[model samples]
Target: MPTVRLPVPSGDVWARTDYETLPDDLPVRVSLVHGNLVLNARRRPVHQRIARRLATCIEDAAPDAWQVDMDVDVLLDDDELEPSEIAPDIVVYSAEHDLYERPIPADLVALVVEVVSPSTKRKDRRIQPTLYAEAQIRHYWRVETDQTAPAFAIYTYELDDATGEYVATGVHHDRLTTTVPFDLDVELKTVREP
Candidate 1:
């Protein structure tokens, strides 16, 4: 039998590949969200800074846990018949497990944060939150960026354990402090400004 080596796809083609064929360390980050592949686009400086600041805040707040960025995926379910995966901007997972390999379920995640970009405003505001809530994620935060004031609108929500759903617990115009995991305070203004 003759051996045939399949040519690897690059750039955008890599993003379009089926989940099973994606190679390790693909040039662009790819995520399977709701059966659709999301390609990582170049981010603006402000967007990058905000994500970094939020990660730092979470780390300081929960010194014992692990905090990560979009590079990691959160697999919501393991049922072979139905697979769900999402990559949020920042995710705080249990410190006890190795998170680099693949998506871990929503139960393992302590918190998820999404920093909005102009291109992803709608998806971030409407679609993504619902998905996270459906996955039974405990805490979800949305960081809205204002171009004029260059400020961030931080909104926090907590899951209703009885109903297994998320409820808007608080909305912060400038900052946020949480009691879960650890005592953490985030200055929304500092994160938004360049």
Candidate 2:
């Protein structure tokens, strides 16, 4: 038999693959959305504030059986991001889930949240929701920061059983008060960007 070598590219073909090049101390965010490289925006204080605040609020409001986590991997597929196996800003799962294992299963996740940024709007507003819905996660939340105001626009979605798509459950601009998975009362306007 003749020896042959496949002509493979030099760099990683996936966004998550390229994400490994980032330095550990770097504050940048990255997501591999369906074999495409979606480089996240420079870290904005407002973005982080929303994500952090929501995590705390959800944890406080959720039942003891539900666990809310931040920046944890939720894998639906081993490689591709179409059936997007990527991380959400925060994921709420059950206490019985095996946290010890890497790449937490999406079925165990009840909710997935994405804090919208200028750079991540398409993914957060559209792409990720489809993926989350396809994964059959019950809830999805998006927090959008205003350009001029010290406030956030939040949207809550519930998966539609018939279509397996997200249905808008609620939309909040002044506050994040809700009673879906559990009661949540977060003052969106007061969340400091600093």
Candidate 3:
């Protein structure tokens, strides 16, 4: 993964009035979470394949009100642009929200998915899920990649309101079939194939 840091400060780029600005054509995925500016590294080939395929499948099955997008920012706070932006790999958001001027709020998001890679495995498995849960995003999915084969690990989670956390609904090694947000059917092998 690639990361570029601004010269302003350790934990923020949006706080200082005199902070240097990002380039007009920033290329990499960037986020501000918990006062830290995070730039996701360039994605591996396999990671891209899985993320796109999964997004396609889900979009096909999702309801008309839901739209699927990749590498889009979700603002943790509806009011501010700093210290809480998270760019999930795939976000299923309701079309009802007028998000043209703002990042999609958690309530408008039906599901957020992250395809795990070597560099992001820990954060994908731990940090992101917790954040999504607390945001009450309702559904979270983590896809674990398998480099040697076309089969991947896919886990589905539902928010447990009592605990403010995600509870595993199922872990699928070959296929994921669910109807939480909408009817979904995804094959791990086909999604991972070259």
Candidate 4:
């Protein structure tokens, strides 16, 4: 006997509800970007592994700091408490604030990292980075899997408070070493490997 398949909804069919109403067990990763629901499937093995390794490196470097996943929302409000948000792959938030909270402001974030997946490459490279910068996020890093060069392209962004925006300070093609908040060094090649 032949089996029938049901039709699935197309083009962002997820329910539009308050982010707080989202169930804890929801299978997909969800975030609100300008009132638009952005739902994504679970990360591929490569992406997950990279995120984990990068998290470890940052933690090792900044022991007192907090590193969180894209599940946590970062709010960017100009006047009212607008929850225009984005969940980055990895975020290092300030140690001064309440780490366990929802919708942490972009100003409180120290670093935001996005691992480029083939499916979301355009969004990751173009849209997300630009939005993060506009939100005045201090540091933004773009990690790309370099099969040809065997290293990741780590780009660091610095925020100019006077302009209320972020600027690309440096693009490190080699292993990255930093002393911005604290002394730390990490080899991009090591993190890029399988």
Best by lDDT: 3
lDDT string, candidate 3, 27-98, tens digits: 666666665667778798878888999899988888889999988777664433344668899999988977
lDDT by candidate, in order shown: 0.71, 0.74, 0.78, 0.70
Cα deviation of 11, candidate 1, in Å: 23
Model 3: how far residue 135 lies from native, Å: 1.0
TM-score of 4: 0.78
Error of 1 at 53 (Å): 1.0
User: What does the lDDT read for residue 164 in candidate 3?
Assistant: 86
Give TM per candidate. Answer: 0.79, 0.77, 0.84, 0.78
Clashing pairs in 3: 1-41, 2-41
**Per-residue alpha-carbon lDDT of candidate 1 for residues 97-176, written as tens digits (9 for 90 to 100):** 57545656677888888888887788777887878888888888888878523555787888888876678878787778
Candidate 4 backbone collisions, by pair: none
lDDT ranking, best first? 3, 2, 1, 4
Which residue segments of model 2 deviate by more than 4 Å?
1-28, 78-83, 148-151, 190-194
Q: For model 2, what is the error of residue 181's alpha carbon versus the real structure, in angstroms, after optimal superposition?
A: 1.5
Worst 10 residues of 3 by lDDT: 11-20
Where in model 1 is the C-alpha error above 4 Å? 1-20, 65-70, 148-151
Work out candidate 4's RMSD over C-alphas.
Answer: 5.1
Q: Write the per-residue lDDT of candidate 2 for residues 1-194, one digit (tens) a residue.
A: 45433223235455344444444454455555565545556757777787887798789889988999988878655454332457799999988887776567878888898888787877788878888888889999988777533656778999999999999988888777877777778876565345
